[model samples]
Target: MQADIQLLLTADGSHTVRHETLGVTYHSIHGAVQESQRVFIELGLQAAFERFANVPLRVFEMGFGTGLNALLTAREAERHGRPVAYTGVEAYPLPPEESQKLNFDVALGTTFLNALHASPWHETVNISPFFTLNKQQTSLQNWQTNERFHLVYYDAFAPSAQPELWEPEIFQRLACFLLPGGLLTTYCSKSYVQRNLRAAGFTVEKHPGPARKREVLRAISPPIL
Candidate 1:
């Protein structure tokens, strides 16, 4: 059964969702927008642009959740007039009723958010001239794609919640789909997680995190020699 979701107002007045059964929140309770901006936008996206600005950027996300990360990415794409192809894979797609109620629009604009939710799955839809989205209603484990990505917004549930997803084999699978020198950012900075990333052949860096957390992890795939 799908876990019931409840809308939550975070410290920054942005909305996140809480899983009624699992007791997990979609984003940080301290401040949702800041966390996404700091980790995904500022760190992940910007870094990708600096290195690979010659071509349209490709992004893959583990959890589509509330479309917060995708919406933010679209906004950046429009601002810079750079093309972005984003793929969000979700095992349990959020119901439209709940996803539509999120307040990310107030801060990041809703045009893309609305389109992101309404867009059909398994099809490439242009949410904006510069941003195209492919929403897949499936888990990463079962997802098959030969498309290589430049950045990965790994926003899955915490390791404590889904231990299987944090293993070395999973990281190896993610690394396989990423282009050489591609970046992967995740909110979890656990020591063992970093070790798993290294075991999967990624070079990991610990970055400062947002409220209630000290650090995050940004892992880079080995560059071609």
Candidate 2:
């Protein structure tokens, strides 16, 4: 079930991909960069930094998509001189030519985009002194790792578009890899999704979202005894 995709300019003048068949955009049409910065960066990464302090951060991104979130996280790690190990899981990766067309690098004034996509799958690649990436080519449902993560960027397509991915069982499985006190953040604010997170043993919160979005969800794992 390969997605028929096309690139489109977003409200913030950044680019995002739309799955033609699913009728869903990879990021918010409001602004791809703005959404990523707000949902995954400010609320997700920054919050993790505050909680973990100077410790190395491990992040697992559910859908690598355009690599925008990873790029933003990498830049943040470099800015703070903090170490971050990022693992992004994508079942169907965008082709090289497709990723090259995204305007994220130009928007952020950085050229790490190509290096991010070119990194070998299933192996860690040091993109910078502070950031390393492991782009795993597997679906989140099937992906497994004994290694736990400090943060999770749940950037999958909307539930309406991909209901299977939003199921409670899937969330439970992902929750197992989150270290106690780790967070899972997403642009989705659906009640069912929140219930699923709660069912998976997360303390979920809804926060003011970015741009046109009203709310986003952030779920934290319970602290270990």
52-88 per-residue lDDT for model 1 (tens digits): 9779999999989889999999999888888999999
Error of 2 at 214 (Å): 0.6
In order, the Cα lDDT scores of the candidates are 0.90, 0.92
Candidates in order, TM-scores: namely: 0.97, 0.97
lDDT of 2 by residue, 1-225 (tens): 344789999999999999998889999899999999999999999999998997999999999989999999999998999999999999989988889899999999877899999999999999999999999999887887999999999998888888998888988887888899999999999999999988888899999999998999999988861
Off by over 4 Å in 1: none
Candidate 1 weakest ten by summed lDDT:
105-114
Which candidate leads in TM-score? 2
